[model samples]
Target: MADPAALSPLAELARRNDPDRFLCALFAPPAQREVLFLLIAFNHELARARQAASNSMTALIRLQWWRDAVEEAATSAAPRRHEVATPLAAALREGRLDAATLQGMIDAREVEMEEDIPSLPALLAYLRGSAGGFAVAAGRTLGAGPEHLAGLQALGAAFGMAALLRGIPAQAMQGRSLLPADLLAERNLTPSDAARDPRQPGTAEVVRQLAGEGQRLLAEGRARAKGLPRAALAAALPARLAARDLARLASTANDPAQPPPPRGLGDRVAVIWGGLVGRG
Candidate 1:
């Protein structure tokens, strides 16, 4: 068992590092939580390392270190200066994780060191690599059923996009825009308008529309994920909550006490276990 205090770094760093991500990690088991944190930390560390040393060669060197660290994580022996590998290696020994998803995550981050996504398709793909990876890692820990796992992936994708959407204003403030150029062009909006702090009035409508679409997808994810076993509860609840939240945000207004849920955790557990196992 991991010391509660030891897991604090994982939890605290996850909270400050990325709240959207930290929420996802919370759905995962503590034993496996470290893997999610290490993946984010590795990406963050690599990004910082690249920025510290200016020039293409320096960035490559740092990325190569990450690559080697990934390779070393596959072996019984550790490599030189492998910070992320420590947790990864422990995960490997305990049969808690593997290398494919983790390596894919590092590779995605390396590609992001210089490139900027300008379209929704590209942004969606990148978001998948970021939060999707975390979802899969957590799913592995929970051993969720396929239906639930699919739902988790979809919900994770939505959460990832939400994070990107939240960062849009910040990016525009820095003179960079991640809004899909096509979306902007089709809507007849300019970067200057989007760059406006809190955005212009019309921007609110656009945000609402995007969130509305996200809510629809989240709805689909939850509907498909309702039949998983009790073991999957830890991960499934968070995804369900996320789906419902995006749905609420997309809607005009909502009652806080009892939000609408097609089939929520409490109800699902009641239907599945209550009738079958609990006679009273």
Candidate 2:
């Protein structure tokens, strides 16, 4: 049995991102490395929390606390009582991590606490949460070089976009949509029209088109990702697979004869390994 205390706060962070689970057998860290994923996972969770909140005030409060915790860890040599922050500081002590990354992570989360990002361009700006912040964190894990950092930024953007796409269904249901409202309007889809049930053909068509756009973005990002830092490449490849599989699933007919995309681990691995990882 592993000693619970032997694990650090960063490990706890990985759990926040559900890093242990993979859809397919394609690309993943070895089991031994699984324990090291806590910090990345935790950062993902905090980012998600900030994004999901409907209220700016609530988001601001949560971000302020996280920011304070990060600051606390940066200055003090010892572990502070804060959960995510303490382990982060501990990780830095063990490794030659950057000060800017830590501050960037906090700042990214802080900005997302407010919910005003509505357009495609604005959405790109709002992505400091995963792309900008995690790019720094990812560099820390992958030898902390400039190339690695740059790769992680592109990788992080691809990963963040995958999650953003998932929220479309949920957002549609809530009537507070995020499908690049202008884009949807241009596609002849009113906000009211896209929110219709998934079983309906219209909604399914919208998903198909959106999924296509997502794949296009992933393709462009993946092309840029080649020759990136190996460590950063490791981080980004999984999302590439995710985007491919999701696009395939969305492209399928919404009819009962065709099943929806795989929600299981096996399908995920197959997609990643079967050349879908980098395919647009």
C-alpha lDDT score of every prediction, in listed order: 0.54, 0.51
Candidate 2, which segments miss by more than 4 Å at Cα? Answer: 1-17, 20-36, 51-54, 77-79, 93-96, 109-116, 128-132, 172-175, 187-210, 229-233, 249-262, 265-280
lDDT of 1 by residue, 102-203 (tens): 666556555445434456576556655655555655666667655566666655567655544545545555544445554555567654556544355444
- Model 2, range 103-128, lDDT digits (tens) per residue? 66666665454333345665555453
Q: Which candidate is the best by lDDT?
A: 1
Off by over 4 Å in 1: 1-8, 19-64, 80-83, 110-116, 145-147, 190-198, 201-206, 234-241, 244-280
lDDT of 2 at 114: 37
Q: Candidate 2 versus the native: TM-score?
A: 0.69
* lDDT (Cα) of model 2: 0.51
Residue 27 error, candidate 2, Å: 7.0
Q: Least accurate stretch of 10 residues (summed lDDT) in model 2? A: 20-29
For each of the candidates, the C-alpha root-mean-square deviation to the true structure, in angstroms, is 7.2, 5.4
TM-score of every prediction relative to native: 0.68, 0.69
